[model samples]
Target: MRPTGPLATIRNRAAAVAYPVFYRLPRGLRRWLVRRVAPTYTVGAVVLLYDIDQAGDRTGQLLLLRQPGNRGWSLPAGLLDRGERPIDGAARELAEETGVELTTGQLTPATPNAVIHHHGRWVDVVFEAQAPATETTLRVDGAEVHDAAWHPLADLPPLSRATARLLAHYGISSPHTPLDPQPTSGQPDQPGPA
Candidate 1:
């Protein structure tokens, strides 16, 4: 076989531990290694909260949070807390960003995606959630989020490119608004998935 060495000894000992045998090394270590190698494994989540109208019609509007950095517009999202359930994190983020309390049923895990750089490197576990069909007053914290609103689906201004892709996958569309035609940026303009 190979020559015995300190590194080899540590590796052999690590392999004997329950963590290594059962779940492999702890996920934190694995993620740390991944981040060190790729620098893109920093994880977070985005919650899409759609407000429905009385007729059971999805109003083609979604709750968005205006963050301190991207002070104009963005989907409600945040970094996952240690040991936090993804659904809980999503709901918490929705409430924290938009001050709307949504039950767990209103949230579901979405596909994982990556953002190369917005403020820094990040990976996102996006989720879709339905806001209750009732109107709730929004109280935004001016530090983290200065504004929160239900934006018409068809009229989203420039948001993160990654979020735009997620919207397309969900077949969401903005209701036709009477506002003047705005020039389309380089990104996709199709309504969200049906």
Candidate 2:
């Protein structure tokens, strides 16, 4: 049974006081404290799905998803649940985000583990798989993914930095040129008042 009423109130009050002090510490110190308190780590996987067109001389296209609120597109990815294997997590995230399902054996590691610091440290495993030449439909969760599409190897939409790096690592060249820096006012460049 769960605690409630006065007991819950007491627990909440304790947490309210403890969390403020905990957050004030430096990130390294806070991570250390959390490690001492409990075993915790963030791990995730990114999946790259390539579509091959057998009829079109087996040309390759890459799948990318546009996330809501994010300017650049990214591969389907998500964090692993407690005790989940990286390969399993990759397959699961791919299915959840893009409705494309794959067995673990079908997925292959594309890069060494990548560690990134965003809200906190994250370790990501990258995987790649080829979609059947006949497969064409793609489905995305409306809330998290605004759009999903496959682009030819030489032609891709604006991509997130990580996606661009991954493509380069795989020896795939992006056809989209980088955009020029825009002014803060969100307008075309203009000379100062004459």
Candidate 3:
């Protein structure tokens, strides 16, 4: 139950005055308290690993990972570990899913900053990187990621909900892009689920 009337005002004022004292606590305790009291949401990073077919030519081919189970095809994405930077998270996920390693500077932000859901629950931070199509070698573990392939923008396989939405936000402009059916407007969707 929430405090009401004078009690609510008192609680707010107390918290405001105690703000400095709160910072004196250990970092781990502070994080734990925040998680216990604050709303929960995930911060994920996704990468559009584009390939250049010819020298200085954009091929429109991007790497997609075929994750095991019902995830279908999706981009290189994963939730950021606690306190991980977005670019570092993107690079880590890309290297983990596909055997392509890239420096954080090699990736560029694809969205305005991060793509937040309408319900303001989860965020998908997008990044784009380019590599030579012929020179890029992809290796998947065949378990976490069943396959890794470079798919042209004109032809794409059935995509997971997160991938579909992120692509649209990145200006794919494909009306026929098959987006998964969402449960409802009020419900927040997972950026990527196993």
Candidate 4:
């Protein structure tokens, strides 16, 4: 949720006046201003799609994607398209980032459906959805997303800061720091000592 009361009113009013001015600036100057002067306010949806591990009798793993913008794995996330609801946005992003298709009805708001101002510049609408572990398939387009996979909640590849914060919000501790995941014994990527 966005800030409310007097501060929000002021910010909204400022944006109202600024939008036209911002758009009118020359493209190069606009780009420079974006980097130096203003922080873009964006609303997006992030999903923690867990596997329903019936045999293990617990939530199996989380679906993560390797996006061009992130240095490491990130949860399925995208900015809400014009006039889109948060849940529907989440469903769309999940389908686009990973090949998994989920209906809005299948998504459970993570503890609460309220907007989360997560790490970095995200105003996120977060959801937790589940599907059968073995039946789910993953695909990446290679243009925007390079990889997609289900990873154990405890043991994860290096994660984006936003992903780590979202997991930590649920009390799931991430072993590695956001940018670099430390090699753990038995993990497929863990390198043997030289």
Q: Model-by-model lDDT, in order? A: 0.63, 0.71, 0.78, 0.73
Candidate 3 Cα RMSD (Å): 4.9
lDDT of 4 at 82: 88
lDDT of 3: 0.78
lDDT of 3 by residue, 114-190 (tens): 77774547887888899886888898888889989988788777777667766766666234456556556523355
Rank ordering of all candidates by lDDT, starting from the highest: 3, 4, 2, 1
Tell me the tens digit of each residue's lDDT in model 2 across 1-194: 77889989999999999999989999999988888887444678888788866554435778888887666777888888889998999999998988888999989988654533332335567787888536667788799888888877777877765556545545665556353454454322321100
Show the lowest summed lDDT stretch of 10 residues, model 4. 185-194
What's each prediction's clash count? Answer: 10, 0, 0, 0
- RMSD, each candidate, Å? 9.7, 14.3, 4.9, 10.4
- The lDDT, on a scale of 0 to 1, for candidate 4 is 0.73
- Cand. 1 TM to true fold: 0.60
lDDT of 1 at 9: 90
Give the TM-score (vs. native) of candidate 2.
Answer: 0.63
Model 3 lDDT at residue 126: 81
Off by over 4 Å in 2: 1-41, 55-58, 113-120, 173-194
lDDT score of residue 134 within candidate 1 = 63
**Please, what is the TM-score per model?**
0.60, 0.63, 0.74, 0.66
Give the per-residue lDDT of model 1 (tens digit) for 8-77: 8997788788455546777888878767766443567678777877776687888866666552466888
In model 3, what is the error at residue 51, expressed in angstroms? Answer: 1.0
